[model samples]
Every structure is written in structure tokens, then in C-alpha cells.
Target chain A: MQQGPDKRFLLLTASLLAALLLGIIVATGMGYMAIGAGDILKIIASRLGGGEALLTDLEPTIPYVVLEVRLPRILTAALVGAGLAMSGVVYQGILLNPLADPYTLGISSGAAFGASLALFANMTLFGHFSTPLFAFVGAILTLLVVMRLSTFNGQISAQTLILSGVIVGAILSAGISFLKYLADEQVAIIIFWLMGSFAASTWQGTGLVAAALLVGLLVSLFFSRDLNIMSLGRRSSDALGVETARVRVLLLLTASLVTAVCVAVTGIIGFIGLIVPHLMRYLVGPDNRRLLPVSTLAGALLLLLADTLTRAVLPVEVPIGVLTALIGGPFFCLIFRQKQKARSYE
Target chain B: MSEQELFAIDQLSFAYGLRPVLDNISLTITPGRFYGIVGPNGCGKTTFLDLLSGGRRPAGGTIRFLGRPLPAYPKRQLARQLALVPQEFDTGFGFTVEEIVLMGRHPHIDRFASPGPEDWRQVDLALERIGIGDLRHRLTGTLSGGQKQRAVVARALAQNTPVLLLDEATASLDIQYTLQIFNLARLLVEDEGRTVVAVVHDLNLAAAYCDQLFFLRDGEIHRSGAVAATMTAETIAEVFGVTCQVGWNDFSQARQLSYRYRSHGGITAAPSPAGLGGSDGA
Candidate 1:
């Protein structure tokens, strides 16, 4: 598949955006307190326009639950999914490895380790913000270390980078395990956070994630051409005037930072970063410019759908992270096998 | 030759870590000439090409491109002036042949800009020139080795730079593609007035195509000049450690290098020019 912005691509993009909006409206109707899609849209429109409530026939508590409570959680999950998917597209493109994701470079585990340590230490230095702050710092530092370890004679080899990520990730994971062993009372808290959930989501947290994602996606799209060149490997990119060192380091930091913020906020949401890019790539192609938007929408939809299924469809509510793994795992294999034979597509 | 020098390299040297790969090399490259650097493995031919194209920095001395210091130009500007057809790459992405060729337009297209109609025309011309226009829609990863090699060269051609570099670029191509690539290089040099410096593994092709030759051995230049002057059997033996007869074929009127078994330099024999005069047309 080659990257092109054709009519079909435009159609798919519009359809995916529409699907995401529909999914959100449908998702808000779940969780014991059912609400109609028309009423949900009216409530959202009334709040967004700062106007009078158009659906006064609906109970005010329904608006409160949808706007103040459920919307924050649902929107946060959607933004985190989009952010992680954007990071995945960047990671895979820059690293020149199809298997690369937010987790492949160990940024997530680094964030997890730092967050776990903060949980055990009962860090209140930044009040409610301390754990996420620690996680962000840990992820940035690990990215620098991984880049340093992979560089040889001013060149960063993909194989070396992957190896460095694995080794560093192993060490950080061990450190996390040791922190778990040391924690006596907060162990359950740490475990649940690691399992990932949006139950604690607030409007403020959703706003933070939304702002981060907006900036990150714009930055990713800005470097989309250079990322395309980078797929040819380092020397070819350089020869094409990509300034491989500068572009690689810039995109690496941008993607890794976005991934860090997502992991810090959500504990550890899996599969969105790994699976969304592939799914969108199969639909569109490998062109970062074309793939980014569709992947973002697809990711938001996938996670929102998974979150909805776990929140209401399942008899016993499971963590969103567990639900994604269960659903995305088989879906990935099926799509991968199916796409293998249809690749002459435009 | 325009009496204008494209590259004026003086005492240029480079090393990988503690080991020197190019040492005290000085050369002048004029515009519109096909220059070939040939040597045995580990003789650092590729390293020399790398330095000339500004892919690798020289450890010492100076290289002036078009009368300006090489490093003074930003990478993007330098790329517009020089392009490199690197050795066969392991493309890890699923970029199509057209997309891969389109990357050569990066030097012309701005970061925020897309490839316009003119740019697409150039890419199409490059694909056609490389004789792969029909396969433009094919994914590069699925191409045969020779097709991939041509696609890489086509990308360099698409760049439309003033100077082009090749690092054993045709070593993997079949004989037909190899000849086609050499012809393209010559046409680029003569008709388009573009300077080309290539590191070639095929000694015979290098002799026939290259206007000038540089022989490297032990991290130093053994000889440099017109192909006929430096491609002698004695120099080939001294540099490549192979005994070869160097002569011009009367049919094609192009110089040729032929290998023959020989004892050590203890016995010297005159080169026999037989069965090589007619146009073999390979």
C-alpha cells in the first residue's frame, strides 16, 4: 500500500469521524442509566453553546451524569487512545520497525515504574499531580538513555535501539517488581492502577489529555514527510536531505513524550498503540500524512468501544486495559491475515 | 571538462573510531565527468564516496563544493547539489516504488509542501528512465533485487542534483541493468552536465564507462587520472591483487580489463589482446 489522498480516503476519514461521534453518543447511554442519542446530543449542544437546555424533558441528573461525570471519562479514554495511536505511528516510522509501538521502546514501562514508585512512596509533593509528574520525568530520561545507547559514530541503528529498549525495560520492570515487594498496604492500589481504568477520570484530567493530544498530533503531522523518508532507513533519509539525526531525535522526543503523558494518565493501556496503526495502515497505507487522522479516529473509536463493552455489556465490569487485550488480540491476527493477500490495493 | 572544479578535496582524511579509513587524500573533480573509484574489499572506496557526498564528515583537511566549504551549507541545500544512490537498502517500510522514488523529490519539496504536478512528472520520468514505469505501483519490498537496485537509482535520478554519488550501487543488478545504469550515469554526465562519482565493483564496466579512475589501497590513493592511465594491469595487480590485462577493444573502442592467472611478480608477461576486439555486446 502506498500513501495517497484519494476520494476513497476522504470518504473513509469522514465515515470514521462519524462513527466515532456515533460511538460516543451510544457509549454515554450505557452503564445502568440509559439516555437517548437525541437527548445526549441536545445536552452536549446546550452545554457547548452556553445556551438554555433544549431537552428539558430529560431529567437534569441525566445531563449531570452525561456531561459532568460520564463525558469526562469517555472523552479521556478517547483522547488517550488517539494520543497513543499517534505515538505508535511516529515510533514505527522513525524506528523503521513495524512492530514498534509506545511500549516497544519501553517509554510506557518507564512511566509505569516511576508511577509505581510514587504510589509506594505516597508521593504528595505535587499533591494529586506527583505520580504523573514522576512518570513523565522517568519516560523522558529513559528515551534519552535509549538514544544514547543506540548511537554509534553519530548513527543510531534500529537493531541497537530495539536491543537497548529491551534491556532497559527489563531493568526498569525488575525495579517495579521490587517496589511492589516493598509496598504492603498500597500494593492493591498500585495493582489496580496498573490494570488501568477511567473510573477516576475528571474534566480537568480530560482537558489536560486533550490539550496534550492536540499539540502532539499537530506536531506529528508536521513531521509526516520526514517520517516517510525515514522509513528508507538512516542513510537514504540523510541522502534525501532529511537531516536524519535532527528529525529522528525531534520525532522520538515528541512521540515518546506523548506516550509518556498517556501512560502517566492511564497507568498502562495496551493494544491501542500497537493495533490502531496497523489497522489504519491496512485501510489507508503507510503514508504518515494520510494514516495519522484515520488512525486517530480509529483508535478513539476502538478504545471507546472497548470501554463501553466493559463498562456495560459485561456482566462483571473488567478493566478497560484487560478488555482491549482480550478483544484487540484476536482482531489483530484476523485483520493481519486478511490484509496480507489484498495488498496490491490503492 | 569546463575548467571549473566541482569538488576540490585537499588532504581529506577520516577514521572510524581509532582506525583510519581514508588518509591524506587530495583530488579535484570537474563538472560533467564520470569518476570511478575501484579497489579490493576494505580499501575504503565507499568511505571515500561517503565523504565526497557529505554523508560522513572528514576527520581532517578540507572539501570545497562549488567553491564553498561543504559543511557551510545546510543539509537540505547540500542535498539539492548532491545526491547519493546508496548501496542496496533493506527497506523496512511498505512504501511503493512510486513513493520510494518520490522521496528523491524531498530536496525540491519543502517540509510543509506536497509534491506538485511538476514533481510527479519528474518522478514518472525517473521511473520510466529506469525502465520500471509499469511497476510503479508495486511495493518496493516485493521487488526483485535488480528491480530494487534500479528503483534506488531512479530515486537518485529523481533528485535532479548537480552531482551524484554511487556506492557499489550496481553490484546487485543483473548485467543488463548494470549496463543500463552505467549508460544513465554517462548520459547524466555528458548530456545533463552532472558530475558523477561512483564506487564500482565491476572493473571492466568502470574502465568502459568512467572518464577518470581513482585506485585506492590501504586507505590511500594508489593512482588517479584518466581511466586508460591508471587502469593498467600492473596497477590493478598492485591495488586489487589481481593480474589483469588492460586494453582497448577495437570494436566498441572502449577500454577493457581482463583477468588472467599469473605467478608472482617474478615473471612479467605481455598482455595478449585476443577475442576481445569484436563487439561482444554484453
Candidate 2:
């Protein structure tokens, strides 16, 4: 007797994701030293085949730009996007607040501070290892601090949580500023890092990001039912056989790890983490079984598209962070306005 | 009543910070009995419900379910036996009524397992039982207060537990809805032979429907017994700090209560026994 809405939301999300991926690949191929779709495929096929034939025919710079440079950057964007979006979904579910995003818990600022410290200290012992590790550590520490500060009598009130997050974020930002002040005269590196860029995107960065994203997304799916119950409120969830506090702590730790890894690789690329999950929620509803996977795919597509635009739309090359903030700012305002309208009706 | 005790609280005491909410209280509920817990606000009715439902651990003493300590039974096992319909819940996401009700199957379903036909059948039956079957496809957020309360009760009923605990299950509902829910509870007790415990504020409703009533005062059981014996005017006035007259109505075969307000330095007059005889005329 219970035949739900016959329309399948999954098919819609999948088709949209496929279209976005195709659009991104085509758009990225249209950069200054344009590679035709046929050549792009040929190069990819040749590389997969472990042959250097495609490289022999192409202009020396073309393969380097497409395969070595832009491909890793695009993959990095997608990985970071998926990770951030997964974190955003988990954070929002745990907080039971729609306004919650990855940054709301200070994870982003903490990672940024860690990266800044790495830059200032000139920690080149293990090359790229120091930055990501420090970022992950910093994010987890910030999460712990915020959790400890907000808790009162074993319950974390909404007001105290938000306040603690803001306070922690402010402190992390101050730390980042301190690092910037101590930075060498070569201020371009600091500025670029702060504004966020994909200039340093590499195979190693993409691999790290992909690993973190996959693990985080998988773990979150396992806890999807708990998250669904948590959205109902802590007391009800507890009554429903969910260990609310333990589940919440695990979710926060997992989300923070993902956010830290993403921020470490690509600074603070805003909006994808905040908006992708929200859009997915609006489209597919709040069933996390659908929400998490769809949000991950949508987040990947969005960042890839944004990265493509950043490369294709300008002559001097735009930082991805600038593009994301510019796009996300308007989208955030639009959503805020819609929420206000909805609230007014209530 | 069945000899099997569904829930037993032994010298249970709980406090919020410095103030004790439940103080050295002990009670036992048996199978197939309709138990009504009534008390003034801040008198520990809800706290006692919480203890029974495993929502709170008592600071002192112990709670046992089915001859075993509550902590010994795994959470899911305990949930399988006892279902709670909380007073209020806020759900931000808009789950359809059918979907929300189906969550009651959580304790029964295995991890990563999809709901089978049996689950859906239970959900449909629950919705039908609550008389909200037509509203199954509607979002829970759009439901009225009474409908929401019914939906929650439907969820609890869907759990298929032998025992049910409700905290003010009909507090915000209209008279019609309140009667409907109480009638459903009565059916569960009489027809299904399940143990139903509810904390109700309306004394008349409790007296009219419940087989037994438990009156709580200051976290302790002030009085408890058959409804007629426990719901006298003296106990009501003493527990609630309000003057009320308890009477019987033969037309409805129900006990009724009429409340009176007392002014300063005024002596409250006792209800006359002749007024009790008016039940025959009605």
C-alpha cells in the first residue's frame, strides 16, 4: 500500500553528474594551448596503454600542460571538493543545523594555520609531508578544543557550539596572520597560499586527497542511520539506541580529518563544501544514503567546473579560491534570502 | 495482571545538579496493565518515564526490565521491548509520514539491511491503526499538532513492543484527538494485552480510562492504586495544591472531577454526598 513517489531521484543526480563531468573535461581542454577532444582521449588512452606514441606527435608543451599540469589540478579539485562536501554533510547532520558547514567548526582555519606555520618554519625535512600532517593535526586539535569548550554538563548547546567554533576560528586566523607577519620578503607565496591556488597541484597531492575523501565518505555512509537519527535531536536519538555522544565525536573527527586533508592540499576553497550538500539535500531529500554519495559527486563536479572556469575565463590565470568565493558569495546570499522568505511564511 | 514484571524501579533516585528530580522511588509495572502516572509539573513524572525508557541512568538504585537489569540488556534489545513516544520532537528534514513511522523497525533491522515487505506491512498497519493511513505520503512537517502526536504514537506502535511508554502523549492535542489516542491506548491494553504506561496531566482522563493511577509529588510516589481509590478530592488537592471535587457520573459510567478556586481567608467547602447521587439522574 505504500508506493512512494514513483520518480527516481538517483537517476536525476547521476545524469546531472555525468553531464557536469563531461562539461568540465571539455571546458578544461579549451585552455590557451587548446587540446582537441580527440587528442585528449588519444593522450589518455596512450598513457593508459603505457606507450609514448601520443607524446611523440604532440607539441612538447601540449602534453606537459594537459597531462602533467592541468589533469592533476583537475583531479585535485574534484578530490578536495568531494572531501569538503562530505565533511559539510556530516557537520550539518551532527549539529542538526542547516547553516552548519565545514568551516563552522574552525577546521578550515585550523588547517590554514597549520599550513601557514609550515610555510613560516620552512619545514622542508620531508618536503610536502610536513604541511598536510601539520594541517591534519591542527584541525583535530581545533575540533577537540571547540568540543571541550562548548560542552556543559555533557550536552553541547547550539549557542555554545557556534560561539566556540567562532572563537577557535578567530584564534586560528590570528595564528595564520602571525605566520604571515614572520614570512620572508617573498610575500607572493604567502598571498597565494592565503587566497588559495592550484598552482602546486600534483599527483602526490591528488592521491592524498583522493584517499582521505574515499575513507571519509565510506565511514560516513556506515553512520548514515545514526546521522539521520541525530537530526531528530540528541535525546530522541539516544532513546532510539544510538550512542549519541560517541557517534557525534566519531563523525566530527572523521569530518575534520577530511577537511584538513583538503585544506592542506588546496588552501581554503570555499562554497563547494557549504553549498553542494545543501543543494543535494534540496534535490534528493535528507536520506543520507542518497545524500552522501550524491553530495560527493556533485561537489566533485562543481569544483572541477569552477577550476575549469578559473583557467579558461582569464588570460593571467585566476586563483581557484577567488573564483569559489566570488561564486559562492552570491549563492550564499541567494540561499539566505530564500530561507528568510521561507521563515517569513512560517 | 500477568506475573511478569515489564519494568521495576528499585530505590531509584536522580537529580539535576543540586535539586533531586526523583527521590528514592520504587515502582513495578506488570504485563497487560494500563498504568497512568499523574503529577504536578517538576514532580518527576517525566524523569521516571526517562528511567524506564533507558533515556537516563539513575544516580542511585537500579532499573530492571524482564527480570534483568536495564544496563545488561543491549540497547537494541531493550529498544525492542520498550518504545517511547516523547512529548515533543523537532525534525528539520521532511521525512514522509510513512518513512518516519518505518524508523521504528530500526531495532529489528540488521545493519546495512534494507526494509523488507514485512517492514512495509507493519508501517502500513500502524498508519492504518492510527487512522492516519491517508496521510502516509504527506511530509511530517506539514502535519498538525494532533496528527504529529498520532504519527509519533504510530511510530511507537510500529515498534511492536510488549511495553510502551508515553510522556504526555496527548498534551497539546484537542479534545477529540486526546480521546482518540486514549481510546487507542485502551485497545492496546485490552485487546492486544500489552503493557501501556502514560504520564497524563488531565486527572479526569486518567480516572476515566486508566485501571490504576500513580500520583507523584516531589519525585516520590504520593499515592497509587485503583483509579477510584487514588483519585479522591483530598489526594488531588494535596498533590496539585488545587481544590477539586471528584464525583461519579452514571450516564457515562465515568468518574469526573470539578475544580474550585479558593480566595484568601476562605474555607473551602466539601462536596456534598447528595451531589454524588445526581449521577443517577444524568
Candidate 3:
């Protein structure tokens, strides 16, 4: 019977969603100003029902700080978290590489280069919109270059794709460094942005990422079964009626666009995409249908936790990107080692 | 031999740029026959398999499926008719045996719909047929080579297509599993009247299992006929570039090919595919 994966998936979905809610409340409560969990819920509830505050016992400064300052940042972090993780699942599945993520195809470096160029030129042409727009364009262009390099005779090969990504990624990194060397006073700002942060998040940015993720996730789920067959390799998937070429291109573009938008907004958040899917695969197996949603929620919880720690728990703030790699690297290795040991028994 | 032609092909050619792997090949495939294509390494057997399965298209000439042109059929519709078990399967992912087998029902399952009870039943039946029912819960990545090969075969079997193509599907299997796959093919042909085309490396297995044999050499069909008549020692030597003995295994009531290193002086290299039985080079 299909009791095992089905039961585990349903249970896992419910629990992970519950965990996300708990994480949001707890993370929002754990900040420097110290808002209670109950208060966080009331503030969120008041906004949800579109009415005045249900519970107004908190100070005026706390509500303003929570809503005007922290909410946009927190929500954007959560949305970007989910979006990146979902794109990561897609990239890893389609490319047939567990090591793949939103950044594996050099999209992050491309975005970084674009953002750096914007900073170097001091182009406040679109006010807050200029850097993110350039970053989006850069990531998409990188995806196109990698895709073109990898494709041959109407088929895409994962081996060539990864190789092309590395090559292009190196070139983009050198470009970013050159731009950095040229930036006299703005180099520090460029470096800071490259480290990733949610300090300047806005509601519109959150909406943009949320919309991208919503559409991207639905498309990903629609083709999840084909993705499952694809892991068998190109020939088998084609033999199974997958229309491998079409699905591969469609999923590739969808995932890359999602990653582009997420990277554009968040300024190159690392490890969320890389780490979330692996952690979710262990908890729930690697079926993309289950993996996509679970990993997304886990990503939101994880980034929120990371952002909260950097913003509130620590005396001095650390870059969210650095924090993730530092924490995620060792824990991922430990989990991977244990996973390998468990797998050897099978 | 008035069997219905399921595939009617003429002047089929395929190439990677200018280097042609399959050139000006023509053949008729009849229903309910187990056909084998075999020759030396890089004989374009895999390439031919890919073309017939529609994983690749013919660079020149035409292939008609049933009565219509091969390209006329939609990809999903074509898949509903023909299924292939590839030579190699990547097991790096963590899909379970059951989940993998269930993927075969994709042609029948709608895009938005998950597999239903009936689909699972078919998957279970295929697993049972391939004798992998007990390993249904196990991860495909964790399976041994032979077991993984069987799982791959099971996925094809689960597709339940009218035409099945196996590209060295049993290459990694044990002797027993090899025989088992052949038997299953024979059963599908005899009992269900399904057409099967397998690219076999083993000469003897081709002899015993396949009713029809196509011996390819240098991208052309060297010989194509009933297996017993087609797989002669001279034909084998000419096509494969080696000497071999053909004898009957009375218990199995089928011919067997045995290789010997001693060079044969009787058969010179066949200049063209037409020179299989005669000395005429053109």
C-alpha cells in the first residue's frame, strides 16, 4: 500500500505548517524589544481581519517598531526563504544534482555583480527599485547563458550545465571584484549588501517575492511527477510520456525566474536554498510534491530564525548570509553523515 | 508471415552532425514478435533503439507507427503505445521502487491528478510480475545492480504499452534474471500479443529469446529474418568480426552462439549488408 509516504507526508505537512506558525510567533517574540508571543499573534490577527487593534496594551513605539519596521523585513525574509527553497528543490530535481541550489547555476553571483554595478554607479535612478531590477536582469541573463551552453541537439545535459555554470560564475565573480576595486567610497556598502540582510525590506518587495513564489510553486507542483521520472535520466522520462524537453525548459525557466526575483530582493542570501531541501528530504522523502512544500515552510522558519538571531539575540548584528553558512555547513555535514550511515543499511 | 506491421520504416537515417550513426536503414516490424538488434560495440543499436522509441527523430526518411507517420502521433499518445527500458538507470535520487513503478502510469494519469488506487494496483501488479513486490518499500538507490535493472524493467512493464523496447535492459542482471526477463518478453508476445524490440549484447540470448533478429553492422542491417535462420555462424562472424560456433540446446530447443578466438578462414568480411549469404558485395 501507499500508506508510508502518504501518511508521513500528510503528518509532516501539518506539523511543519504548525512549526512555521510557532516559529514566526517565537521568532517575533525573541527580538531585542521583547514582544510576547500573544502580542505578536494579536498584532498579526488585527491586520488579517482588517480592523483596529484587538489588544492595545502595548506601547505606541512597540506597534510601530513591529509593523512599520520589522514586519516587512520579517515577511520578506520568510517569503524569500520559501521562494529560494522552492527554486532549490526545482533546480536539484531537474538538474539531477543534490548539490544544486538557486545559486548553483551562478545566478547569485550574477545578481551580486548587477547589484554591485548599480552601487558602484550610485544609480538611484529608480530610487529603491534600481539595484533589484538590475539584479533580476543579471540572474536571468546568467540562466540563459548557462542554458545555451549546456544544450546540444535539442537536449540538455546536467553535466555540461553545471560546468557552464561554474565557468560563467567565475567570470561574474571577477567582474564583481573589478567593480568593487573601482568603487572608492561605496565599496563598503556594496560589500555589506553582498553579505545579505533584511534591514531595509519593504512591503512591496515582500509582495513581489510572494507573487513570484506563488506562481513558481504552483507550476513546480504541476510538473512534480515528471520531475520524479526525470531523475531516472532523460531517456526513461521521455519513454514515460514526460515530453522531457518541454518540461525541462519550462521548469528551468520557472525556477530560475523565482530564484532571480528572490536573489534580487534579498541581496544574495546563501544556504537557505542549499540546506532546506536536504533537511526536508531527510524528514520527508525526495518526492518533489512533498519536498517542495515542506522545504518551503522549513526555509521560512529557518531564515526567520537566522534573521531573528542576527537582529535581536546577538549584541552586534551579523550578515544573515554568513550566519546561515556558518550554522548550516556543520549541521548539514552532520546530517549528511548520519544520512549516509542510515542509507548504508538499506 | 502475414502478421500486421506495427511499424513500417523506410530509409531511416540519423546522425550527430555529419557523422552518421544510422544511415539509410529500412525495416518492417510485425506485432507479437520479440525482435533483437545486435552487433559489435558502437553498431548503432542504441541509436536505433532511441529512434524507434521517439527519444530522437530521424534525420532522413520516414517511420510509420501503425498506419500513420511516426511524428503524427502526439508524444503522450506515442508513449501510450511504446515504452522503453533504458540501458542504464541513475539511482542517485531517493525514489522508492513503488514510486518509480507508479510513474509508468503517467501516460494515463492526468497532469493535475495523483495516481489513484487503480494506478497503484497496476504498479503493484508490475512489481509482482517482475518479482520485486517484496522490495516495493525499498529505495531504488539502495538496490543492487541486478535489482535496479529489474526495477527499471518493471517500470517499463508497468507502462503496459503495446510496443516495448529494451536497450540492454538485462545487461547488469544475473543469469537467472536474464532468463526471467526473456521469459517475460516471450510471455508478453505470446499471451498478450505485444511487440517487443530489445538491443541485446548476448548472442545466445538473442537466439533463444527473440523471434526476429536484425544484425546491424556500420549503421546498416546486415541481416534481418527469423532468428533461427538469421543467426548462423558465418553471419555472426561477418557481422561481429569474430569466429563463433552455432549449436542447438535440445533442452531449451533453441540455438546457442559460442565464441572462439581461432580466426575463421571460411567467411571474409561481408562488404555490404546484402552479402550475408552470398559473395556479391553490391
TM-scores for every predicted model: 0.93, 0.91, 0.93
Candidate 3 local lDDT, A63-179, one digit each (tens): 677787888888888888998889889999988998888667888888888899999999999998999998999899898999999988877888888899989999999999999
The TM-score that candidate 3 achieves is 0.93
lDDT of 2 at B49: 84
The candidate 1 chain A region of ten consecutive residues with least summed lDDT is: A1-10
lDDT of 2 by residue, A1-346 (tens): 3223224565866686787678656865877777887777777778789588767777777767777888888888888888888888998888877778767888888887877777778778667787777777788888889999998667666567778998999988887877787787635566677677777899999998989888898899999987887777765666666777778888888888888888888888887878988888777788887888888888888888888777776767788888898999899889868856654212
**Chain B TM per candidate, please?**
0.90, 0.90, 0.90
Descending-TM-score candidate ranking: 3, 1, 2
Candidate 3, residue A176: CA error in Å?
0.6
What is candidate 2's CAPRI-style docking category based on DockQ?
Answer: acceptable
lDDT of model 1 at position A180: 91
Compared with the true structure, what per-residue lDDT tens digits does model 2 show for residues B1-282?
234777787899977666577777888888898999998766778878888888777889988887888878767788788889888776547677877788888887887998898887888888988899888888777777778778888888888888889888898788987888899889999999988899988888898889989898777788989988888988987777667678997865889887754674333543332211111000
Residue-level lDDT for A290 in candidate 1: 86
lDDT of 3 by residue, B1-282 (tens): 233878889999887766677778999998989999988677688888888988888999998888788877777898889999988777548888887888889898988886887887788789998999899889887788899889888988888899999988898888998989899999999999999999998988899999999998888888999987998988987787666789898977899977654455643453444322211110
Clashing residue pairs found in predicted model 2: none
For all predictions in the order shown, the interface RMSD in Å is 4.0, 2.3, 2.3
Q: lDDT ranking from best to worst?
A: 3, 1, 2
